[model samples]
Target: MKTANKPRTSGSGTKRNGAAANGKKMPDVNGPAGDGKRPSLYANVIKQFDKAADMMRLDGNIRKILASTMNEIIVNFPVKMDDGRIEIFRGYRVQHNDVLGPFKGGLRYHPAVNIDEVRALATWMTWKSAIAEIPYGGAKGGIQIDPSRQKYSINELERITRRFTFALGNNIGPEYDIPAPDVNTNPQIMAWIMDTYLQMMPPHERQRCIHVVTGKPIKSGGSLGRDKATGQGVVYLIERWAEEQGFDLDGSTYIVQGFGNVGSWAARLMKPHGAKMVAVEDVAGALYNPEGIDPDDLIAYAKEHSDIFGYPDAKPIDHMAFMGTKADIFIPAALESQITALTAPMLKVRLVAEGANGPTDPDGDRILLERGIHLIPDILCNSGGVIVSYFEWLQNKRSEFWDLDEVDAKLKKKIVSAYERVQGVAHHYKTDWRNAAYIVALTRLENVYKERGIFP
Candidate 1:
């Protein structure tokens, strides 16, 4: 519990910009490269913050507060595997800020998990909630093992999750730090967190603590539209951007990277609106079918094969080809720094909708801007999940449940409002969308801090 504020370093011991500084090979983003020292995803986040902070002339005190995390919790928990081996897994929870309310973020399961990355993610969650006008902050936690390769049995995973939860202890609560699901994690995992946390609580408090974690199974006090919230948000922002830019979605083609939760859902939703997914690259492989790939078929293959490795309907494409493929729009839903200086130039789309957190580094972002590619920053682009998570939290607190239609409708309204606000700010400041987004969030936070003043 006391490990909540320990600053984490990337395993490689390289600075955020150090990887490139050391002449490391920059290639396609393989979902957060996990070699020795992983690049500072947290550094990328702070770079964005510093750029915006300087431009906005933010108060130095609040700027410092916003620059660092509020707490970072690291846990070394033991779990008995199905193989009868007791293994220890390292986990983390980085709470960025709670100036508005509770800290909310996702708990992921990935080999690339580290203090720097989670800290970056938690920081983004703070700005994201602020931009969405939600009364929540940011936090992120995950273990540093590849779930895909580990093949942990359900019982094994449940044990690992429960033990991790027990170790987290009172660091998480309904009105404190609430974590949802992230990469390789799902609603089922969220349920495990809820169940474990409740079991650890006082008998009288168990029933009222469902809000301790969100993105749970619908029957488990989860919101109806939570599963597709992030993807839906990505497309929502894209659709609005299209409307403003006079780009028609009906006949436009898009390329998506990381065909997992966000990419697959966005493709499926966009298909009904007549958009085409001409290319997709995932961990399994890359596929290109310029004639338009069927989302249903691809989704089915991914579900069965665990990756879209060899779908019969589409031809395999290399990562280079995947990035270089010409299309109307491109969505990077994979991991941070995917759109680096090398890959960014390969992108041939007029617009980029970032469905993943910090998909484009500042350098990649600069190139995209220079190339005249419109971008919807991750904070604004993939905020549908948190917005709906906020809804679920409110629902659980109020003992009210909403239907799918109601949930979707509210999500759309919130995203659209946020989109318009960011656009307005960008236009007024004559700045890029990424900077404008930060400006929007910072303004809200600044106003709050300015009005309330810092506590004694």
Candidate 2:
């Protein structure tokens, strides 16, 4: 078992060192422009935390600790390509805090992966776990390579994943830090990570470490509802909101930004509610159909065509027009800083449910607040994935498997409880939902810190 407060070393015997090694420098967070007109992703995260901390009067010491990551693990590992060439790839695993429990989050693979983005996501994971009242802290990992853009063959992808896992070594463990699926990652990738991690352990210990990563294939110890957890969580919150407002979901129109796992699942799940998806957007293009585009059809087409660009039922629509489309609900499940100040004004939705982390910047948040557009913040809205991941981890630890119905019921209960807590905090403090969520999480962590005083 790993010792508390002890940093895990990589396979190379180095601990938490990567940025400055080998004459490589960490990128300037302020980008090339450096005009300060746009803040870096991590900067925006700190701003949010500061706002909630000031409002809640968080403890100075704890605030200082939470303001920065506890561990930033960077590794530059080499992977062999299909063309008989070796390429060096940089990977990151940022552990923000573990005051609540073990560090828990997802591993994403994207071209834009950077320390700032990973740090921001890791910080959010800590808040997400606290808000959900789960016994997990926060962490996030990523490899700086676009799985699609790089055109890596399956063999190359598997090799890269295994090499990255081997590099992570003890830094990730079933009880220390567990990774699940995020952007451009899925069960197959998770299986590779788990296998690679298991192979690094003794034969007897390997069996106990099947859950070194969550979101694996069910046969590989993944949970039944794990795949749809985040989207299901999003829909659950939306359902609760609709019930509270006495709004009929039947025949309501909605738009989705990003047709990936979360967006597609959320859209498909909303079908039973009789809701219609009128518009959808992704990295490639946008689609619109006032009569409603079928989620099942779009997803199937996307699976085959690799995008939602040419679905016959929906006509091509520009981003501006798509955002301006009349709808009762808008789900931004795409990249960070998507719904900025410029795009926020174009949204004609009654609600903005963030499925992606940091989809709204400070300026966009102000616009939404000013426009009275209700929002279910990313921390609370997209927490189902982690909640179900917790369930999976528990199951693996105990050698048990739950059916889909059981998983869904448990997820609903946990997320709804969190929602109620946020709602109560919002009502009590008379604040926005985002601020209310942070307050709830910060209050929980603050109490924990008070109870378990810091060790010398």
Question: In model 1, how large is the Cα lDDT of residue 384?
Answer: 91
Question: Which regions of candidate 2 deviate over 4 angstroms?
Answer: 1-40, 78-89, 110-112, 146-153
Stretches of model 1 off by over 4 angstroms after superposition: 7-41, 76-90, 110-112, 144-153, 304-306
Q: Would you list the clashing residue pairs of candidate 2?
A: none
Across 297-410, the per-residue lDDT of candidate 1 in tens digits comes to 899989998999889988998999999999999989988789989999988999999999778987898899899989999889999989999999999999999999989889
* Predictions in order: lDDT: 0.86, 0.89
**Candidate 1: lDDT of 163?**
92
Displacement of the residue 210 alpha carbon in candidate 1, Å:
0.8
TM-scores vs. true structure, each candidate: 0.85, 0.87
Model 1 lDDT-worst window of ten: 19-28
The residue pairs in collision within model 1 are 4-72, 12-37
Model 2 over residues 133-210: C-alpha lDDT tens digits?
A: 999999998998778734778898999999999988999999899998888999999999999999999998999999
